[model samples]
Target chain A: MSRFSFNQITAKPWTLPEMVAGCVAAGVDQVALWREPVAEYGLDRAAALVRDAGLRVTTLCRSGFFQLPGWFDDNRRAIDEAAALRAPVLVLVSGGLPEGSRDLAGAREHVADAIGRLVPDAAAAGVTLAVEPLHPMYAADRCVISTWDQALAIAERHPAEHVGVTVDTYHLWWDDTVLEKIARAGDRIAIYQLADWITPLPAGVLTGRGLPGDGCIDMRAFHDAVDKAGYRGPIEVEVMNADLWERPGRDVLAATMTSFERSFRGR
Target chain B: MSRFSFNQITAKPWTLPEMVAGCVAAGVDQVALWREPVAEYGLDRAAALVRDAGLRVTTLCRSGFFQLPGWFDDNRRAIDEAAALRAPVLVLVSGGLPEGSRDLAGAREHVADAIGRLVPDAAAAGVTLAVEPLHPMYAADRCVISTWDQALAIAERHPAEHVGVTVDTYHLWWDDTVLEKIARAGDRIAIYQLADWITPLPAGVLTGRGLPGDGCIDMRAFHDAVDKAGYRGPIEVEVMNADLWERPGRDVLAATMTSFERSFRGR
Candidate 1:
């Protein structure tokens, strides 16, 4: 439970203050936050609230849609926000192909180059730019980086402190070879997020993630891999399920803690 | 056009006789067939219908649910049907995790062993068992095999004439390493298929594929890779789209042909 961090997406409706209070009541020491809610609640205020509540911000959820018009400015702002919040990492979900484009290879190249451009700013902010490879199902509209190899390739191009791969089990568990490669990743692993892969994925494939033990993923394999990679960081339970979001934040946090114990400790 | 084969799923509602006749009228020389409708239309009659129409059967749709009971016998029956239709290839989609099993590695091993057990029968029927790596979205419930490397690894275990890999652009387009690997695959390429990856995938995700030029896959890249691999087999369009299914069979065939020409011939 000490390593467990409750990602804010697990309870979608919970505001920053409510979430902080709920996590405090549930005895969660850390959280992974999304950019939208943080921006909505005012980044500095949200940061102060979490800090005052004695909760560590594990990561800031994303700012890397390179295909968009103002990606450069947006990512820079995200880096600033992460620094202000004292979050060590900012997750980057490289956006999918530009509209009407069939150039996936080109899109990937642009991601690497875009991340390279952000490396200096991220380094200056003392935040790791965690390149997250979303599931291949999202390759068209969400993220072109759909494998650990792709994320690692881009990350290896820069200093490990500035850029590293985000290992999310939901996006990567289908890969048979990823576990072994992840074990060898060493300091290149930025943040490890857990969300089990469940079937009958809803339209858009976004909010269909399962709680750790509710799905078929062998969480032991991921835990062992991350451990072998020498990553000593908070493991965030970042499930995004419609059903889970309907529950109270405290209940969701409790269930998340239980899932973490069952998946990580195999209780 | 001599190399173009219309896979029956592109026109789901078309009967075997109608599909064969439609192919003939459209100057199509080959087709890839599914097992269900063929069985419904009477295997012998379906075979005769295609044979009489001078339409060569490029490959039989599939038969490799190794996780299920009687997979061996079912695959053998499929092999016999392929033999009856004079189809040179039998595409295999290795079934997902058994009922509640979380051992993906174990499931993959079972697939390899199951295929090994069926290789002799497939070889005797002069049919190449083409292992298809489905998109990873289907890895949990539909197919365990989810990458070019996984499919190739299994295929390399048997004689190239007996077992080979199916290269479908829809399943493998997101893989950056696959194009170069496919170029070096040589005769291990049994069947080459095309279906573009479209956005906003519907529930279940089984029928969300786009026609060749309708989505973001670089079709020419795939064509070049297969050609570089020295493959001379027929190319099949195997899209499964809900929107496409609502149209008349002839219109679907025409639209599919147009997509193929635009994607392969490039205007």
Candidate 2:
């Protein structure tokens, strides 16, 4: 339980204060936060709220999208936000292909270059930029980095403290070689996230993830791999499902905890 | 135009006779046939219809759902049908994880073993079993084999003449190393398919693919890679869009051909 963290996106409608209170009430001492709600609640206020409640911010949800305009400034701002919140990691979902482009290889090269340019800011802010490889289904619009190898390659280009990979079960369970690769990744795994892969993916293919034990992913396998890599950091449950979001935040957190326990059952 | 083969599923509403006639009318002398419609039209008649139309059957659309109850016998029947139609290749979409199972590695191993079991029958039928690695999006309920490397690995274990990989642009395009891997695949390239990857994937995540040039896949890149691999074979434009299925057979074929030409324009 000490290693469990509830990513705020798992309960999308929860206000920052409400989420903080709910975490404290539920005996959860750690959380992973997204930028939007944190900004809406006022970054300093949100940071103070979590800190006063004695909750650790495991990560600042995201900051990459290098394909978008002003990404450089936007990401630097994100780095500042992570620093302000005292979060040690900022997740990076490398944006999809530049608009109207079929040059995937070029797009990928740009992401690596973009990350290199941001390493200095990350190092200064003391925020490790965790490059997350989204599922291949999102290679076009949501994210271009679509494999663990791709993320690790980019991360290997920089110091481990400034850059590392996010190992999310939902995005990577399909790859046969991912487990062994994750095991070998060692300290390069900045943050380990949990979400299960569900079938009949909804339109847009986003917000369809399952809770850890609700779908086909072998959660224990991922747990074992992460353990083998010597990662003792918080394990975040970062599921995004429309149905789960419709429920009350407390219920969502409870369900997430239940699923996490089930996933690690007998471990 | 000489290399063009319209996969039958592109015009789902077209009867086998109508499809064969439409292909002939469009000056397309090659086709890839699906088993359901062929069985519906009566396999022998469907075979004779295409053969009589002077159409070369490039591949029999599919036959590997190894996780299904009667896959062994069913696949053998499909191989026989492909032989009857004189299609040199039978594409295999290795079925998803076994019912309610999270053991992806075990499932994948089973697929390899199942294919090994089918290799003798395939060799005897003079059919190359084309193992298609579906997009990882389909890894849950469709095909567990979801990468060019996995397909190639399995194909390499068998005689190339008896087993090979299906290179579909939509499936492999997201892979950074796919182009080079395909380029070195040589004779393991059994069938080269083209379908662009369009976003906002509809429910079920199937039947939403785009025509060659309508989406982000670089078809010309695939063409260059296959050419580098020395594969001089039918290039099947195998797109399965719900909207496309609603169009007339002739219109779909014409649109596919136009997209194909546009994809290779200036090449």
> Tens-digit lDDT track for model 1 on A143-262?
999999999999999999999999999999999999999999999999999999888899878888999989999999999999999999999999999999889888898999999999
Question: Which DockQ-derived CAPRI band holds candidate 2?
Answer: high
lDDT measured at residue B46 in model 2 versus the true structure, 0 to 100: 88
lDDT of 1 by residue, B9-65 (tens): 999999888898888999999999999999999999999899989999999998999
The recovered share of true contacts, given per candidate in order, is: 0.86, 0.95
Question: What are the per-residue Cα lDDT tens digits for candidate 2 across B1-267?
Answer: 889898999999999889888988889999999999999989999888999999999999898989999999999999999999999999999999889998898888999999999999999999999999999988989899999989988998999999999999989999999989899988999999999999789988898999988899888888999999999999999999999989998999999999888888878
lDDT of 1: 0.93
Could you report the DockQ of all the candidates, in the order they appear?
0.87, 0.92
For all candidates, the clash counts are 0, 0
Overall lDDT per candidate, in order of appearance: 0.93, 0.94
Instruction: For candidate 1, give the lDDT of residue A231.
Output: 95
- Position A37, candidate 1: lDDT: 97
* Model 1: DockQ vs. true structure: 0.87
